[model samples]
Target: MLNLVELPDPEPGDGQVLVEIDRVGVNYADTHQAENSYLSPSSLPLVPGGEVVGRTPDGRRVVALLNGGGGYAERAVADLPVAVDVPDGVDDTTALSFIVQGSTAWLLLRRSTHLEAGESVVVHAAAGGVGSIAVQLAKAWGAGRVIATASSAEKRALALELGADVAIDSRAEDMKGALIEANGGKRVDIVLDMTGGTVTDQSVASLAPFGRLGFYGMASRELPQAIGPGSLLAHSTTVAGMWLPHVFSLPGNVFSQAMGELFELAAAGTVRAVDGGVYGLSEARAAHEALRSRGTTGKLTLDPSR
Candidate 1:
């Protein structure tokens, strides 16, 4: 439903500055935005982009995250807080990844569940944008064991290389068994789930006592079974979810701190982006199709200059 029609360039509103975008992050949330199935509501004729790295009028390079979806265009009106100068040594796409995917990965452990050292962690979609980084971060932050699952062996191997203690096929027939087996016959202590449907059901069933699971993406377009009090009471499990826009309220310092931490990680070689590929502005539709195909690995981007 995307049309490459020319529209007048946007002007900065009050407290907003104009940015000539260098790179636009193509997030799974943007795909949901286009389909009108996002967690929140949207009307027709929307521009689909949540994060971008660009230059302001004075030529300061900055990273911006917009919930209003104007980033697919040549320019967007970014305000002070959601817009911050890109750190030294980080590329446009890598900075954009931190705004959404990287921050989400951090909050999944730091906020959603206080990851205790030595706790077993499982990361589904282990080669995708967030999962790939989560695998590395879990290890860097002191996880005892990290289990990574992906649909391909190359991805599983990549997870293993990124410090995962174990890797398994995401398409295992007995999902629960595969996870438990990968953990050396023990239930997982924490889980980060993006793939839904049976993958979620099996993961929930594989939770250890006092286990915690955080849901961020449902790329499979499948919802997990509704949970009841009985399900949690039996094992004392906890479940939580997060959306990035909610964290920007204290924008002056909130997300900025997270970006700083990720930048440090990047500088130390503790983490890096998995470049999925960059498409031209006119090829936004194609990019969404690639995401819907669910075959993309790492982070995909769009070049607004085209």
Candidate 2:
């Protein structure tokens, strides 16, 4: 049912910019919104995308996070605060990756887990947009040993290339045992659990004493089982949850600080934006399917000009 339609150009209100979008970052949340399963209910007749790279009316190229969801089109409106200049060395697609996936990776380590140098960590869906960046950022931030999980060998290889110390098949029957073995017979300090459901509980069980489990997205669409407080207390482990929408809704300079750190890393090449696939704007349905299929690696993007 995806259709391209003609609409009037959006006018920029105060503190808003009319951006001519060149590329848009395809995200799992977009699929959630489309299916009406997103935690934050998007209004009806919504244009389904949140991040894009575009030029403002005055001709400044920028990466923008569209709070109102219009990133699927050739033009969209962006708030001034969330819009930042794309670095000279970065392309539109890479820059578009930074606004959501990049910052999410940064926040998982920097804010939620407070991961320290030499701490062993596990990242699920390690070849994905956020997980790919997370793998790089974990190394850059001094993680001692990073273990990643992906469905395919190619994706696992990509995770290793991105800086994961070890990569394991996520569908392994003995996932917890595999993670333990990967950490050298010891449990990991942190688990960045993106694929909720059963994985969340397993991640909690795989934690070392005083470990932290940082749960974010539930791309698996499986109902997450609850973690028993007694079990966590026995191991002195903590389970922390983060939703990007909640992070973005916070007041003060939190969003800017997190994004600034990620952008700096991207500019310096300490972290790279992994490119998975690209599709024309008119092929948005295909883009969403690609995102959900788990058949692609890196960041998926949409080119309006294509």
Candidate 3:
């Protein structure tokens, strides 16, 4: 359904600027948005993209977040405040990763749970755009143990290389046991997961007292059963939900600060978003298919010029 079309160029509104699109960050959210199942509803003639790396009229290369979804085309309207300058010498893919996924991962640790030093942390979808970065950031930020869960052997190896102390199968029959077993037979202090359903149930059960669960996505069709106050009281656990755009609303230029730090880490090669695959503008549908298939790892990008 993501067919190529030509239309009048989009005009910028107040506080926005037109960007000549270069590279688009294709996220799992796009797949849900395409099916009209995203947190926000989609309208007719929707363009299923949210982040991109492009150049503004001033010729400055930047990575931008499109609040209302217009990143797949040759141009998009970027809110100036949400667009940040891409570091010199960074490629389009790395720059784009530093936006949505990178920012989300950083906030997950810094804000979502205020991850404490020496706390054992778990990162589900360990080889994903957000999960991949979260693993390294947690370790760099002083997590005692970083347990990663991925669906494949290759991804598990990648997570291990990215500073994860342990990697377990995400589809394990006894997810909670697998998590505790991987953590040296002890409950974890923090868990970061976009996966819902049974995996979420296990994550919640695997938490130590006063542990926190940072829920971000619903890669699985079903949601986690973690909202019961009674269960929370008994477990001494907390659930913190994260919607990336909402992070921008926090005081003190929350998102911009996080992006700046993540860029520094990425530039230093301290952390990197895994490279999934790149597709052309016309291949947007195919990209979504690959993401939903759960076989792709790291970050998937789109080249609009192709």
lDDT of each: 0.87, 0.87, 0.89
- Please give each candidate's TM-score: 0.97, 0.96, 0.98
Tell me the TM-score of model 3.
Answer: 0.98
Q: CA shift at 140, candidate 2, in angstroms?
A: 0.8
Off by over 4 Å in 1: 249-252
lDDT, candidate 2, at 111 = 84
Off by over 4 Å in 3: none
True lDDT of residue 244, candidate 2: 79
Query: How well does candidate 1 match the true structure in TM-score terms?
Result: 0.97
- What's the distance in Å from true for residue 11, model 3? 1.1
Count of clashes, each model: 0, 0, 0
lDDT of candidate 1 over 128-154, digit per residue (tens): 889989998999999999999988888
Candidate 2: clashing pairs of residues? none
Location of the lowest summed lDDT over 10 successive residues in candidate 2? 244-253
After superposition on all C-alphas, the RMSD of every candidate to the true structure, in Å, is 1.4, 1.3, 1.1
